[model samples]
Each structure stands twice: as structure tokens, then as C-alpha cells.
Target: MPIKLHDFQQEVVNKFFKSGSLLCVLPTGTGKTVVALEIIRRLKEQYGNKTKCLIVVPANLRSNFVDTIRKFQLKLNAEIIQKVSQLDQAYRTKTILVISYDFMRLYALKLLRYKWTLIVADEVHYAKNRQTKNFAVLYQLRLNSRHFLGLTASPIANTPEEFFTILIIVTGDRSIFAEGMQLIKYMEIGRKDPTWWEKLKATLTGRRPRSKKGELIPIGIKDIEAFRRLVGRWVYIPHYSKIEKLGTRPKVKSFVVRVDLDDFETKAYKYALRKIPRQDLKDLKEGTITNARLRQIKNIIMACQQTLLSPDYIYEYEERGQEGVEQSNISLFRPGSKIKAVAKFLKQTGEKTIVFSSFLRFGARLANHYFNKLGIKSREYSGAVKPQERKEIIKQFEEGDLQVICLTGAGQEGMNLPSCKNVFFLNLPWHGEILRQVVGRALRITSKNPFVRMFWLFAYTKDGQETIDLWLSNLIKRKDIIRNAIFAALQETTANVSVQLPSYEGPRPKSKRKPDTVLGINYPR
Candidate 1:
């Protein structure tokens, strides 16, 4: 049976087949899996039973992919390959084999020996870091495969440089841009007053770059439009609004809610900051901190953040000797203002909500508070929860048995919670991409709620002095500027270019739109 596809997805699939390698970016809940499956089905039909496909996904997402295939009722021979020993047998028999990134990294060389007709990397941004072993493994596999596909909702999560590896993998051109110094030079090709060199020198010598006006100008993307044009050729990004059949996605209302810490908590925060070494503080003030000094400074900052959240996290960290700073002598079990604020917000909304925390102890403490204090049915979802238990928790949350769930970073990647519309961040991650992925758990296209409300909870001082939360928020805003600029380019490219389909041996379905020019390449229209 032929699988049904939305018009935009069909168009995207057509583009992938024509180009042989491409990156497909679709907003969460917009059915990226369906597009991949449709491409797989076509490859099977075109190449016969001998066609081989490898789908690499994050560990937590493996089940989601399998469940999607089952829901679609697709008869494609897909199997989850868990062991390196099973790889050989599965490679011979299965038409499509899905493996996790962790497993792939472990058996990279073994898997590289085999040829795959198509390689689909879901959440492909995981390989964006060139320093990661997964990137090296995926790079080789991309070279070995006949066709490569990278899928992600947020490609440039942190910076534009993250896209460099993904581009090289798809385009298979290591020298496409050039090496480090030359690459930086290329990025500054059109700049009138190039500052990359000065920035690099300052960075190496523990100094800051300043403009002619003596204002700090952080080194960042100089020409986002040029980068967009470069990356636009290999990417196909479609929004739900553009694809009418996908239905209207609810508009998201995001808020940054500031909570004031109580008197004692404020005192504890100040005490924690005082515990940092005077030399370290001076280094930070002078912007001359080494790697070790920077790490210690980060630890102190985290201790201060934990101070804002709860005393329980601080005690736990102190016990583990994780927080080098001294813990304030206060009641460790008492819930602080942030925790109380979260409880109040949850009780007031009375909607299914998910609280995200980067720290495990904080999430557990919050979940415990909800269950014991507020009487709201809640549980913790993190790496500590067994896979089977995680499934049960998700079932409970979806079926209304649970009202709140505290999710840690471990559960962020592959967990889908469309039933949840309210997301509260007890803590902020350093990267904007991570924040997006966590929020994506609820902002699915299939969500029942019309609007997904996201609250970023922050703690501030009475004097309005900026804290880690505010600093992190500002960082995310800067990162978003890069993402929005590149996405704008991709959106324009998608609108202007038309994919030229190959001639079919038999009949073809009719369409109202005609083939248009793409990247100066002429084909049958």
C-alpha cells in the first residue's frame, strides 16, 4: 500500500531523492519521521529487496522511532539493532535497521565496513561537535553511504560553527571551507574592519576585544546571509503554517517569571558567593582566568544557583563534594521561594505540567514537594528511572494519572509529551538548542492544547543585580539571533527553488506547480 504524505513532506522527499544528500529541518510535532519513512519506502521500491538503510538516533529516541513505524502500519522490515554481534545478521536480513548513537560510536569501524543505501541521522545536531567521537563515526558513515539524510528541528543550536560538521558530512567536502585560520578568514571575507584576528589574540592572552568606541564586541558570525546561502543549498525547512494540511499550530506564549528569594535564602546566596577564593574573584574581574580557574568559578556560580532553588540541592552537592564552596548553615530540608513559586504556579494552572531541571537533586526535590506537599501526583523522569519505569511514567502522565513530572536533561532528547502544555524551567541550560529540545517535548503539532505556555523561572536580588539565570537568558538571546538569521535564509531558499524530479520509466502523478530554477541547474520543467 502507498503511504500518504502531506504536500510539503512529499516535496521534501522529492528534493532528497534528487539531491542524494540533504538536511531536513521540520518543527517538532510536524512529522519528520513520516518523511524519513516515506523516503525509506521509496528506496525499497526503487532498489528492490536488496536495499539497505541505517537509521541512527539518540538512545532514548529508538523506541519512539519503532513506535512510529507501528502506528503508521508500515510493513517495512525495520529492526532495532542493539548489539554489535547482531549487526551482521541484521544487516543481511533487515531492510532498515535503527541503531543508537552510543552503540554506533562503540562499533563505528565494524559498521563502517558495510555499505548502506541510505543513512538517516535523527536529531542529527548531536554530531555537530567536531570533537565528539560520534561525529567522527558519522562522518565516515556519511562517506560510505550512497545517500545521507540529516534531520533536526534546531540545526544551529548554539552557533553557526556547529553547522560546519553537518555540512561537511552531507557535502562530503572537508576542505569545502578550509582549515581553522583560513576558515576564520573566509568568515571575515567581506568585513570592512575584520576583528577575528584581534579577538583570537585577545582570547589566547586572556583579554577582551573592544571596538573603536571602547565597547566590547564579542566575536560572532559576521555575514549570516552568506552562511545562510551556503547552508541553504543542503537544507529543506518547512513550517506547519506553510503546509495547510498539517493544521494550524498553536502560538506559543513564553514568559520569564522572576521570583524573589526569601530573606534567609538571600543571605545564603551571598554567603556562597563569599566562599569563592579572592584570587579567583580577582581573575574573573580582570578577565584573566585560566581553564581551571574558570571551572572553579562555574562551580561557585552553580552553588549560588542551587542556593536560589533549594537548600536540599546544596546539601546533596556538598555531601558529594561537588560544590567546592561552603554550604550555609541553614535548614536543608525546607523548600525555598523558587520551589514554593513552582508549586503555587502548578496548583493555580491545574494543568498537566513538566518541570525541567538540569540538576537531578533539584528535580527530585521538586517532584517530592509536589507529591507530598501539594498532593499533586508527580514523579521524577531522569536517567535514574529504568526504561520500563520511564514508559510507565509517560503512560501515567498521558492518561491523567499523573499531574506533574519533573524532567531532567537525561529525559529531554526523545520524550514526547504533547499531552503537557505547560513547561516550567527550574534551571536554564547553557545552550539554547538544549532549551529548545526540552520545550519541544510539549510543543508538538499533535498537542491537544491550543497554546503551549513556557515559563522560565529566575531568581533575582532585591537590588536587581544580575544572577546566573539572567546571564544565561542573555546568552540564549544572543544565540537565537544567529539561529533566526540562518533560518530566514533557508526559508527564502525553500520558497524560491523547485526540485526537479527524475524521469520515471512509467506514469507519473500530475501536479499544478511547474518545475522552477534551482541553484542555476537546468532540468526538465
Candidate 2:
């Protein structure tokens, strides 16, 4: 059977009915592609049979779309392929061609030759940056071109001006939401209307026709009209609750594992810390430091952190803009107590686990050594891994073929590994966005009772204490420090943007800390 449009999708298609361009904001895994497919069908029939469509998505998602097309049996009526090169080679006319944003950037002039009847950009948030090459290429290709569409789960911007730019591109009207309808306000509107809320639920989900077409719940026309007026005919469906349909999440317990740094590690960390300019550190807190200096400080901190884990990671960047060579091959090797600690924990539990490091070389080294010596199957994933192979490795890990999967930043976002109930953090990222994404990977929802055991291996400062143990706590502190420092440094009249960090509440075990810190978060089962 051909993929039929759900009521939510149908409503969107009806809104864009004869319109040439649209910006749809639906959640991920919600079949935005189906909406795109429906729009394509409607355009071909109403606009003209000769009208063609182009789709741009992240490189990793290209194959997923190809699979989605075949799985939905869209081949009968839709002209969809995996990549642009395939279509370019054929020189055959296909109504729809799917390509990556990278491809679009590299071959912008060549692709601009085609008068695209419609262009759909999936994960449209990539275009939020007006200065990006992707943004530049997309703008050129869609110049004066009608029938362009953009899609994203979240359309967020740090500043109002940035948000306005997105609004103009999406609505094609500078006056859109001119009454100061903030994007945050639009996100909150769904909770106030039940009918719209239902459509939102349907839009975020990818479930099949659980209810018959006649029995399907319908959203109110008046509500839709009101939303249209507010956000300008653009579909802005934000999840009222991120995991509402996931039922219940497993218990998340956080326990800190403090390891004493050896003599070599202590000397290395102290040396690095001493070399860092105290004024730069002060500037970081005062928000007076340049971005370059802030990054340099961050790199120093990260290197010291790595040294605590494995002293072999310490590298001195020469003034020549390259790393200094070591005296001997053995000089680069060290007794990695941190790696030993992780392996000990894994050996004791002997269950499915995910080990995360911030660097690919370290993660790969750890994974390779563990598997080689212990004869335990494992794999490492990072930007270095082939896109196709990453999927296969994740599949194998999920299927229990691999006992563990060591990963860098790649594991942080939107990858499902619910089967692994245990997570070991070998290194922590300073960015809250990254830290949250990593911890979230091991989280899985199930009807039955499920528990997640999270372990954080951290080293102490000169005073022998970890300033921040919890990622959320550290994030909150970091925000306060930076905002205050920036405000103080600039002494500008501009108001500070309020911070809104996600907070989840659930049952909590008794804590010896302060009462407020006991807010039932990170379910400890």
C-alpha cells in the first residue's frame, strides 16, 4: 500500500494547497518526508506534470530516505533516489532528487542550473545561520524560486534578530508575527488548545493508522486558523512534552568515581595549569576574553583532563603551529590507570555498555585494546567512521553482537541504544548541549521497569576536588558565570537573555546534600 497521509499531514498539505513555498516545523521521526511527498504529489497534479522537486538533507540521513522511499513503496508514483550524483550520471529526468547539504555547497553553481519546481530542505535548522556556506548555497538555489520548503523539529535562535531572519525566510514576510509573537510563545500555544495538541501529537509520532480514517480525531478549523494568523500559515509543531509517548523512562542513577592522579599525571596537569594565564581565566569569568583565548583555555582544560585519564594524551603544540615530536615511541605510551578503571568496571558487570570519550583517537585506542586483549567484541564510532559503517556498527551493538561500542561526539545526538543500560563517561564535554546528548543515549523507555546506571570518571583539581560532578549543575553554573561576566564586561544597555535549561522531576533517593539538590532528577532505580 502507498503511504497515506495522516490527518495532521493532510491538513498541512491542504494549507499549502496551491502555495509555491512553505516552511514546516514538525518533530523528528514524524514523517516530515511524507508531508513533503504529499506536497510533491499535489504540486505535480495542480501546478504541472513537468514540475520537479529537490530534497536536501544531512549526509547521514540520505540513505535513510532512500530506505524510507522503498519501505513506503513510493517508487510507483514518486521519483526519489538516494543521492544527486546518481541522478546526475543518469541524465534521465526524474521529478524528485534527494541530495546532501554538503553536495549542495560543493556543486551549488552546477545545481543552480536546474529551475527547481520545489526544493525541500530537511533538518532545515542548518540554514538558521545566515553566514553559513549551506545557507549561502540554499539562498542562491532558491533565489526568486517559488515552491521551496524547509523542515525542522525545532526552529530556535539565541537572539530575536536571528529568529526574525528565520521567520522572514519561512513566512516570506517581514511583518510576520509583528505583534511580538516570540518563538517561545508559539511553542507554548499547543498546551492551551486540545485539538491542536492532538494534531501535534500525531505530527511528532510515526505510528500507523491506529484509528480508521473516519474515526481519526480532527483538529478544529478555528484553532488552525488562529495558529495560521499567529505564525503565518507555517506549521510550527513543538512537542509539549519531549517524551510523552515514550510512556516512562528508566531510572537514571549518577555516581561519581574519583581516581587519584599518579605522580606523572599530577606533574603534567599542574604544569599545564600553571602555564595558563590567570588573567585569561579571570577574563573567562568576566566575559572579557576573546573567543580565541576562551577556546585556548578550554583546550588546556581538556588536555589536562585527558592527561588525568592517560598521560600519553598530553601533546605540546609548538610555536610552528604543529605538535612537537617525542623522543621515542615509548615516550608516547603510558600506564593508563583511567582505562584500567573502566575495564575493571566492565569486567565486573560484564553487561552491554557504552563508553564515551571526547576524542576519536582515545576512544578508538581504548576500544581496540579492550577487544584485542579481552577477546570481547567492540567497535568505535566517530566522524572518522564511514557513514554506512556507523549504522551497521550501531545495528550490531544493538543486536548484542558487540559487547561494547566506544564512541566520541557522534554518539551524542539522536542515536538509539536503549538496550545498553549502562554508560561510562571517560571524558565530559564542557558544553551542556553535548553532555546532555551523551547521557541521554543510554536512556530507554519501556513498559516494564528499566534502570540506567551512569558512571562519571573525573579527576580532582589542585585542591583535590571536582568542582562540578553533575552535568546539569555545572551547566547552570556555567550559564550564570558567563552571562554575568558578559554583562559586566560590555556594560551595555542590552538586556540579558533568560536561560531555560530542561529539568525533569521524578522519584529520588535520599541525598545527603542540600534539600534543593534532591529535586527528583535522573531517576535512581
Candidate 3:
């Protein structure tokens, strides 16, 4: 049986072959991996034994690529290089080598000795920070490979800097955008009005610097029209909405479940906030906290956020029990309202659900509550578990052995969870793109559900006092506004039919709402 690709995916493959390097921005669950695999098959057929590919993914996602290969019956020789010792044999024989970002960083120099015909960075945005070893190694790898592919659903998460870093790695041109703000000047909206750029910067950063004289008037849309025109040559975005072959993805109904904190929670949250130095809070308001002070402020904010989740987390319980498993006797501490709300909702829904939480301990507590308290089969999926155990946990969830899987940030990206159609967020992620990635795990093309349900748990005090939940949610909303405007520019770009290969020259680079019903559940006031 031959592998068939959607028309848009075929277009992505065409772009990659013509340009030799591409930043593929396909929406999640739309088969980005299939496209990459198709490319590899062609490479193998064209180049044969000479075809060597390097796939860099987050540690947890390495297995996903390997599994897809087997599932599709693509008898490709793929190897997972765990330690430096195994690299020599794999480098010599394995046509496809899947290495995690962390392992690649650790053994970059040694791995660099081998030549790769193609390199694919899965979830490449992990290298957004130029200072980290992630970016450094990826840049070197891209330079070594004859063809490079950067795969990510959301290219510009929060700021242009992320896209800029990826641009540098893909093109090896560091001077194109100098800084992220330079990329913004090319936007048509800002080019027509320089003040628009400044306002945008201020709004995105929550800091307003005095407008300076002699600002660079954007050369013109011809110089580079926003992000799309600038990186137009090297980037190909096949959005899910535009894919006719997909017919229509399962509709996702999102709701914000407001959980009211009980008296104990309210008092604990207020006390934690009050314990923070008044001066630090003032600095936060003024947006003048030093980097050191910023860390302290984050710690305080984290403490208060934990206060809403569980008292066990607030007390700093070990993420895993003494037996090296995530199971914990959460009964020791009174479960918080948020936990009760999540458990109750899962009980009522009685479906496979993935509950995402930032805190590892909170994830453990939720899993414990589901099984021990509610008699619902559950397990904790986090980095704390061994790779094999994580695989088994996912299997159990898929096979109906587990009713719910409490996942941490580790499993947010690249993990396919089409088995589950319900996603619950214990709290909001720092970036909007992460929120999308987590939701994408359940929105698979193979899903049987007619629609997916996503719920975000937000805690508030009855007295109308603003909690950190409200603050974070509002912040994400504002960031989403900026993210939407930037990516929306890509929609305006006219696709080029002529296949002109790109040179390593320079850089470049919202929703209506129906009132969702609040979960009508009673909590002790």
C-alpha cells in the first residue's frame, strides 16, 4: 500500500525539496509526522544507503516518531541513540537516528562527526532561546545537513524572538533581524504607522519605553511584508482550517470552569499574598523588578497558585512516593476546591481525560484522588516516571485500563492522545501556544469523537478578590491578541508557485465566542 498525503502536505514536501530547508507550520493532529515520513521515504528511494537523517525531538517525543514508522509499516531502519557509546554503531548503519534535544546537547560534538543528509527538528521552537545549548546545537546540525526541516505548530508563540532564533538556525544568517523588535517593523500595520510598532511592543511586554526620534521607517512591504513576506521563501504553513481533504476536524468546545475557593483556601491565598514584601508588589506593578527580584516574585506567585491546587503541594510534598512511583496518600492533606472540582467533573463525565498541570506534585495528587477517592482508575504521567512506565501508562489509558491520565508539562508537546477526547487544564500555561499544543494531543485525525471538550479550571474567592488565576488568564488573553495579529499576517501571503531555492541570505520573520455554560456543580461556600 502506498502512503497518501493530503494536498497541503504534498505542497509542504514540494516546498522542502525546492528550498532544501523549510519551517513547516502545520496545525497539530493534521499529520505533520506523516509529511516528514513521506519525505524520508523519498529520500531513501532516491539516495538509498547514502540517505542518513537526524531527528531531534523532546525526550518524551522520541518514541512517537519511532512508533509512527512501525504503525505505518514503513520498514525504515530507525534507531534511538540513548548514550554516547551506542552512537557509533547507529551512525554507521541506522538510516534514521532519533535523538532527544537534551542528549544531542550532551553529545553534539561527537555526533557532529557523522554526516547527515537531512535533519528534522520536531517541535523546533524549543530552541527559541539563542543563549541555550539547544539553539547552539541545532544551528550546528542544520549547517551540517544538506536539508533541514523545522516542525512546529505555532511558530511565533509569544514574541518574534522565537521565530528570529529559528530563522537564524535555518538560514545561518545572524545579522538579518539583529533583534526581535526589528522583525516587527516589517509588519504592514506598523510600517504605515511607526507608533503602532511602539504601542505593540509596549502592550506585548507590558512596558512602555519613551518613543524615540529617528526610528527606522520600515522600507516598505516589498522590503518584507510582516513575517510572511520576510521568511516567505523558507516557510510553508498549511493550516488545518484550509485542508479540504480533512473534511472537518472534531469541534472543540472550550469552557472556563470557575472553582470558588473555600474559606480555608481563601485565607491561605490571602496570607501568602500578604507575606510577599509590599515593595516587591509595588515593583511588579511598576514593571521595574530586577531579574533577581523577578525570580522572587515568581516564587511568591507560584506559592499562591499552589495554594489553590492542593495543601499537599503547598507543603512541598515529594513528587513521587518513597516507592519511586507517583502514587501518594493525598488523604493526609485536605484536597483543595480545584481538586474536588476536577474529580467531580471527571466522575460525572466518566470518560478518558488528560488533566494538564504544571506542578508535578499536583498531578500526582489529582491521579491519587481519581483512583483512591473516586474509585476511578488513574495514573500520573510525568518526567518522574521511567520511559517504559510512561509508555505503559499511555497504553493503559488507551486500552481503557485507566480512566484518566494526569499529565504534567513534560507530555504537553508531540504526544498523540487521540484515545482521549476530553482535556482539562488545572491551570493556564504561560504561553498560548502551549495551550494549543496540549489541546492538539486530543484533536487527532484518527479520533472517533464528534467533538472534544476542553475545560480550564480557574479559582476565585467569593469575596471578589482577584486571584493569581484571574491575573494569569488575563495575561494569556492579552498575549493571544499579539500572537493572533502576527500569525494572521501569514494568512495574507500569496503562495509562490515557482520553485526557486532560497539562499542563506537574511532573516525575516482570534476568536468569536459563544457563552459556554459554566459547570453547574455545588461547592461548600
The prediction achieving the highest lDDT against the true structure is 3
Q: Residue 346 lDDT in model 3?
A: 70
User: Runs in model 2 with CA error above 4 Å?
Assistant: 1-48, 75-92, 152-169, 172-237, 246-263, 283-293, 296-298, 315-341, 367-375, 410-418, 422-424, 435-457, 461-463, 467-525
lDDT of 2 at 21: 66
What shift in Å separates residue 239 of candidate 1 from its native position after superposition? 4.6
Tell me the alpha-carbon RMSD of every candidate.
Answer: 13.0, 13.0, 8.5
Give each model's whole-structure lDDT. Answer: 0.67, 0.54, 0.68
The C-alpha local distance difference test score for the whole of candidate 2 amounts to: 0.54
Candidate 1 backbone collisions, by pair: none
Q: Could you give candidate 2's per-residue lDDT for residues 86-109 as a string of tens digits?
A: 666432466677787888887788
Number of clashes recorded per candidate: 0, 2, 0
lDDT of 3 by residue, 1-525 (tens): 346987788888898888888888776788888888888888889899999999999887888778889999996899988888988888788889999999999998997998889999999999988899999999998888888888987776655667768878877678644633545532222122434434532222212232222122121122235456567767787543465347545657666666777787787777777767886664443323333444557767776777677654544423442343235554555767877887887778678888888877655455455455678788887777898898788788887568888888777776667778778777766666777777777777777777777777667776755566655664454345445544545652322111111111111111244433434443211
- Give the local distance difference test score of model 1: 0.67
> What's the CA RMSD of model 2 in angstroms?
13.0
Among these predictions, the greatest TM-score belongs to 3
Q: Rank the candidates by lDDT, best first.
A: 3, 1, 2
Q: How many pairs in model 2 have backbone atoms within 3 A of each other, for residues 3 or more apart or on separate chains, i.e. clashes?
A: 2
Q: Write the per-residue lDDT of candidate 1 for residues 1-525, one digit (tens) a residue.
A: 556877777878988988888898776667788899889888988999889999999887787767878898887888898988898899889999999999999989899899999999998988988899978899899989999999987777655557667778877778543331122211111122334334442222112233332222223334555555566567888743464344544446566566677667776676776877876554433333333345557867677667777755554565667543233332345766766777776666667888888876644545455555667778888888888999899999998678888888887777778888777788777667667677778766577777677777667665554455665565455446446645555653332111111121211244676643222211123
User: Least accurate stretch of 10 residues (summed lDDT) in model 2?
Assistant: 183-192
